[model samples]
Target: MQVSREEILHIADLADLNIEEEKIDKYLLNLQDILNFANIVNKQDVSNLEITIGSNEAKNVFRKDEVKVFENTESLLENAPKKEQNMFKIPKVIN
Candidate 1:
């Protein structure tokens, strides 16, 4: 597949990208290479293969959940730079 400079410019405009004039040719060549590689992959024969979405093997691999004692609040908050009423205080992140 051939990707032209005009097509690249149109795609950039649609995607809100500001591609410099000097880089347009390189971008067009790279896009064409990617399309060519995709074409090659599309021609591969996989008609007899089973459709597997994930790994074929499964294993039991989860830790058992149980109640456990944690350190006191004062000890837990000792490393925090800011704390208020046994809770860690962080800078406001949302408007």
Candidate 2:
């Protein structure tokens, strides 16, 4: 598609762009090239190809769910600066 100088100016105005008069020709040529490439891409054939969302042989390899218990509570709260009723305590954060 051939883009006219007036059309380029109108596009620039609609996009709120400050395009110089000398740069308009360059922008027009670039836009034409992009459109031509898009037209070429639109003519591609992908009829036999399958649409895959992720990697080809991907599976969720997760560990089995298991229950574990800790034997020490005092050792876990040793490094805490404040402790109350077997739990760590801190200053109020929200008003």
lDDT of each: 0.85, 0.86
Candidates in order, TM-scores: namely 0.45, 0.42
Q: What value does the lDDT take at residue 67 in candidate 1? A: 83
Candidate 2 TM-score, C-alpha based: 0.42
Model 1 per-residue lDDT tens digits across residues 1-44: 77777888899999999999898888888888889878976798
Off by over 4 Å in 2: 41-95
* RMSD over all Cα atoms, model 2: 13.8
Residue-wise lDDT of candidate 2 within 1-93, one digit each (tens)? 778889989989999998998898899999988888888756878778877778766677899799888888679999789999788899999
Residue-pair clashes per candidate, as listed? 0, 0
Candidate 1 local Cα displacement, residue 88, angstroms: 28
RMSD of each: 7.9, 13.8
Model 2 weakest lDDT span, ten residues long: 50-59
